[model samples]
Target: MTVDAVEEPFRTQLTVRLRQGDTLLGVPLPGPCTFTSGNGIDILWMGPDEYLVLGLELSRESSDLEAELSRESSVLAVVDVSAQRNVYRLTGVHAADVLAHGCAIDLEVAPVGTCVQTLLARTGIVLMVREDGFTVLVRQSFSDYFRAWLADASLEYVS
Candidate 1:
């Protein structure tokens, strides 16, 4: 198949709930339907007061990150949700087409930093649009199902 799926398991993920106008990782939290990346971390806006911080190859443990984040005065909760979800990357020319089969959003029009919580193949996922492809975050329990569904969805593009 032209579309390739790869799983990136067990990277640090933090759920931070903070007061208005708070900042993390030296960058302000993104606005609705958007995400920001800096200092080896990507911060995605999850709600009015919540953001999902994705760490990339950070030298610290999830707990360490949590403790550091919790130190902020405006921070209300800093949870290490690393074990709660699995990440998948879909790439290749047909990637978006494969996603279109199950996702309702028009990801092609969405900017590279766009991120949204939605359902794909009836499974809840946090989808991030990227220049290379797309990143899909699904609950750990539903990862297998989502992978299988992704495989099935890309079948037609195989020739």
Candidate 2:
């Protein structure tokens, strides 16, 4: 009998929030789809009233993401989402196809350089465009199940 081993990919999540201020480290924040960059982070404008700060791997011990901004005398609230999410980067030629099985939104129309928060297989998900693939963010509790589902959906391409 032959033993089969399945190799899964690696993933990580980073939750980012910013302080309400006139500027972020001398760089002014713009309206709509604008972004501000500094301190190894990219602040993305998600909506008229919402923003998402993207950064490197954050430390689990640092529960307060707004501490730095707070110290800078900016009005901001700390958002603790350490246990709320998981992030995965999906590559390969079949990346879009794998997502098609779960996501209702058309990837072709989504276009690259855009970020969308939608549902996948009835679960909430955030999709980000990349040069060669896409990044998917989902709640932590559903990560394992989502990964398994993704593997099954990708079987056609893997074979």
Candidate 3:
């Protein structure tokens, strides 16, 4: 297995809660249990009216989004909590199998471009399936445990 911690860009995560009919930071809203991207941003839908906005080097974009959201009458809340979570990426042939050891999601059959909030090593996580692997996000407090568990889960496949 090939697992590496991703050096995230200057984080500017903006959690946006919509009041109604509001798109996310000018990007189209994602469907249920879906993710949508525009420009360099990816919006992960957390609920009917909530989303998490993420991207690389998104400082300026974050500010613009925050201000834009403030002007929208339909916006419920826009809060930045960029430092609250840590992200890691695991890619390679055995990546999914390793994650499956602790992740409840069926990565073996999940389609590409899928993202779901699930548990990894009993830790809350967001798992994003890409073309060849998965991106895992864990809350700050559990990041260390998540990483350790990932290392152990990957031992069978790692050389």
Candidate 4:
């Protein structure tokens, strides 16, 4: 018997930490820019005074984006977190059901296009739900385990 391997598309994640009173890329973000990933990237408000920037593609310099922000003020600290985390997308009708198994947040009330940083099976995960699917961000060290768990949870709907 011959079996075909399932191919999953990869999504890149870039995380940048912005300090308080610092503007991103010289662009003054008055108040926490809601739903604005800053430069069309996936950004999240990690704390009252902190923001986590994510993106699918990165520039050659690595610090290109951060440098732009630094031009405005010297108070912001931008750090590249590409090597520290893994990003995944989960979609389909059963997406919510699968997430409900391990996620602590209430998906029903979270609404679409909204992002939430929460725990999944004791591990920290950032979840963003859209109309088609949900994007999940997890630590690189736990990616393998997390993927395995996600696959297992998605078994029921794959076929």
Best by lDDT: 1
The per-model lDDT (C-alpha) reads 0.87, 0.60, 0.76, 0.61
Specify the highest-TM-score model's number. 1
Q: What is the descending TM-score order?
A: 1, 3, 4, 2
- Which segments of candidate 2 are over 4 A away from where they belong? 1-39, 58-65, 71-75
Cα-based RMSD of the predictions, in order?
A: 1.4, 5.5, 2.1, 4.9
* Residue 42, model 4: Cα distance from true site in angstroms: 2.1
Per-residue accuracy of model 3 over 1-159 as CA lDDT, tens digit each: 255445455556778888887465577877776677776677888888888888656446667766866787778888987788887778887887888788778877888777788888789887777775777778989877877887788788876
lDDT tens digits, residue span 59-136, model 2: 313434445544545534445454566777787777787788989878877656557778888889777765667767
Tell me the TM-score of each prediction against the true structure: 0.93, 0.70, 0.87, 0.75
Q: Model 4, 23-79: lDDT tens per residue?
A: 555334423323344444555656665666655454334466556544544445666
* Candidate 1 per-residue lDDT over residues 34-107, each given as its tens digit: 99987768899999999999887655678777887888888888888998999988888999999999999997
Model 4 error, position 93 (Å): 1.3
Superposed on all Cα atoms, model 2 deviates from the true structure by an RMSD in Å of 5.5
